[model samples]
Target: MSPAASKRQADLLKQEGNAFFQKERISAAIDAYTGAITLCPNVAVYWTNRALCYKKRNEWTKVEEDCRTAIQLENHSVKAHYMLGLALVNRQKLSEGIKALEKSLELGRGAHPASYMVEAIWQQLSKAKYIEWESLSRERATQLRKLKVACKEAICNYNSLGNPAADAPEEQLNELEEVFKKAAKTDTPTEVPDHLCCKITLDIFRDPVITPSGITYERAALFGHLHMVGKFDPVTREALEPHQLVPNLAIKEAVDSFLSEHGWAYKIR
Candidate 1:
């Protein structure tokens, strides 16, 4: 086959894979994308598409392998990095995963600040950062507790040695105690404001939409409720439909501005 014909064939396979993926036929989608990759081995998107299929099945190793190939083929591929980050996270490689996620966020923001993917990448990065922060905070607290116990022991030994004039160990113990108290206070989790959250998902607004009744919800969550539950506002129980929802630009901008300063808001439960 000529290169042009092979490229055309790969494009057709990609479309088939997309259709299969949309239908939730993940195995078939993977096979289709594999065919595309076989036809056009240098194409980065084919590898990423197959990686997404693996991701759906929780096959972290396959996802990582395919994403790495995609990244090698196209270093600046945002989806490649994003999926790689998720794959690494599933594999329990948090630090590496966070780096990949941060790269994806940076690329996505540069390419399309208003794209759905930019927000998705930002949210994932924020959650990863929060998890890392929480883990480190716990470890530090544990170390501080151990240090406090040891400091008190040292002070006791110093006093028992008939060295009551030795203020050095006692002063160190007081300083350590004060540091532990401050750490405890600083580690307390802050609550996210309810107004910033979607009623159905109770998550920070991603694509917020307001209904006629002045109730706002995450776009996808509201769509799910309307399709699966009923065409009424989840909060007010008022009559509503998918068409009644309007993009709340004011709220969206507010949420975006807040997240710019407080990425930790993505730590929503």
Candidate 2:
């Protein structure tokens, strides 16, 4: 067959693989993608598609191999790099995964800015970072998790009281606020811990915000970055808008507690 004919045949197989994949016929999708790759070894998409099938099967080694082959065939293959990053992270090669994800983000920004896959890539990167952070600070991470739970419980109890009438006793609301504020303020540390600081501002968060990507940052700092820099998240490079940020009340409470305990941490240079 001529090269054009061969490519067309490969395209048909790829489309078949896509259909199978969408149907969740993972093994059949793999077979179709493999057929495409055999027919058009030079096509990066064939390898990437096969890699995705392997990913669905939790076959990290095969995913890594196929994505590497795809990247070799087409250096600018965004899906390949993104998949490779996920495979690497699954294999506990976090640093390499982060680099691959960053490369994918860089390449994808110009070519496929609106692709939904970009969000997945960013989420994977975020997971990798969280894993790394947890590994390094397991104890502190546990503490933070507990603190978040406590904060949530506090909020839930307050809300369960129901909406008070506008004129009904302002003192009651103020008293409740003071109680929690006092709890957070009871123990001031001499120095602010690194984990408590916002990654973007390198300072304590006054108002913490969480993005859909599961990253937390200072509200104003993240808002500014989204508006002034780009719509992509700072940590994961995922697409995000200011409106997508949710107030991370738990983290906010935790930060407030930390600050209260370590009043000196509030002294910013």
Candidate 3:
């Protein structure tokens, strides 16, 4: 068959796959997509379609494999990255999954800023980040506890030996104690950056939205303020409406990156 004939056949097969997928015939959809992939091996969409079918069947490993191939064929394929992220998460590779999801969101936002798919990807990324933060927080707490115990033990041993010449120095022991003291000082609130915080709530932004006046606010707080007060910007006090609010993805991403590095900040509420 000519190259053009092969391309036409592949397109038809992909259409068949889409029809099967719409009817919830996942196995049939996978088969159709596989046929398209076989004919047009370079087509990223065929591989992504197959990956979607695998995802529906909870076949995460296959989804991962297909998505990886699609990404290799077209690195900017948002669907490929999104499916790969979910597959990796289901396969117990949360960190890699989160990265893939982040890339998908970045690409989706750039290519389709107002696309509904961008919001869906953002929601998944949010959930993934939360899970990662939760796990890391518990792990770090356990490690801190162990370190404090070790520090106490070292101090006690030095004291019992009456400061033997070979014992750890008093300076080292003091520093270790100081480290735990600071670590245990959970009462000291994490200092969130001014730009990442809402002016109205004075708290770190969870869901940031931008007003028409070019000011950002926490979504819930802004909504509450508008309901209780009036249709005006809290900071500017200019005429504002709910429809004028837009998601502040840049600030939200910055907050997410900061929280990822400083899991302690997640407790700031």
Candidate 4:
């Protein structure tokens, strides 16, 4: 096929995909996007659109892959990054997801602040000194609900069913709300003590800026949290450890690898 004909076909597929998406026909939309990608794989938008469709369809893995491809084709694509971030966030890949969303913001999409929703929940509630978690925005509350449930699931999967916090019973979720009020912010505040319950206090899961200091970005973030509300648990503490936790290491490495692979300069220190 001629280049012009391929471009025209790709455009048509994209248009049909958009129309189907607007009608809430996720599968059809995906099919159209797939067609577009097949016709002109060079255009990042085709992959990006398909990513969104997969996201709406709850095809989280596909969403991540498509968005990653889109970003590779157009590194400045805020929408693509945002969509990828949401997919990761929903899958509880909080560290990596937040990193993508933050990149989207840096690329000029502030309204896409939805990336920070999860951390914000536990952080903010901790700051208020009350457990009025039900008052969160609908979407945010839903994410938290999911997070709570996921924590519960994790605990159950690990055979630690007795820990009510991990299980997140209503009373426990509510009771934990008060920690936010007394939290502090620090770039390197201490990690959560092994015996203490883990949680974010104060709605400040805001990303911490990493400079030339010996601290990792996540450590800086933990410190920022400490400065804001002075509270944390095992979950937050893993960031600064010499051998960062699995999820944190994965994300930190992903960013560095992504940048390095693309010939962009970034340093951990």
Which pairs of residues collide in candidate 1?
none
What digit string (tens of lDDT, one per residue) describes model 4 on residues 156-240?
5654446544544554445444432232111112333221211233211233223233233343345455456544323434233
Native-to-model Cα distance after best TM-score fit, residue 145 in candidate 3, in Å: 2.0
- Candidate 1 residue-wise lDDT, 61-131, digit = tens: 99999999999999999999999999998788999999999899779856854467877887787778677
Which pairs of residues have clashing backbones in candidate 2? 187-261, 188-261, 188-262, 189-261, 189-262
lDDT tens digits, residues 1-269, model 3? Answer: 89899999999999999999999998898899999988889999999999999988899999999999999999999999999999988887999999999899889867865456776787788778777766766777788989888877867776788856655566777788788778755423367778988898787776689987799997767777888899899888898888888999999899978775665334333
**Residues forming the 10-long window of minimal summed lDDT in candidate 4:** 180-189
TM-score of each: 0.69, 0.52, 0.69, 0.44
Name the weakest run of 10 consecutive residues (lDDT summed) in model 3: 260-269
Candidates ranked by lDDT: 1, 3, 2, 4
Between the candidate structures 1 and 2, which one is better when assessed by TM-score?
1
Model 4, CA-based lDDT: 0.57
Give the top-scoring candidate (lDDT).
Answer: 1
Q: Candidate 2's C-alpha lDDT?
A: 0.77
- Badly placed stretches (over 4 Å) of model 3 are 159-212, 217-257, 264-269
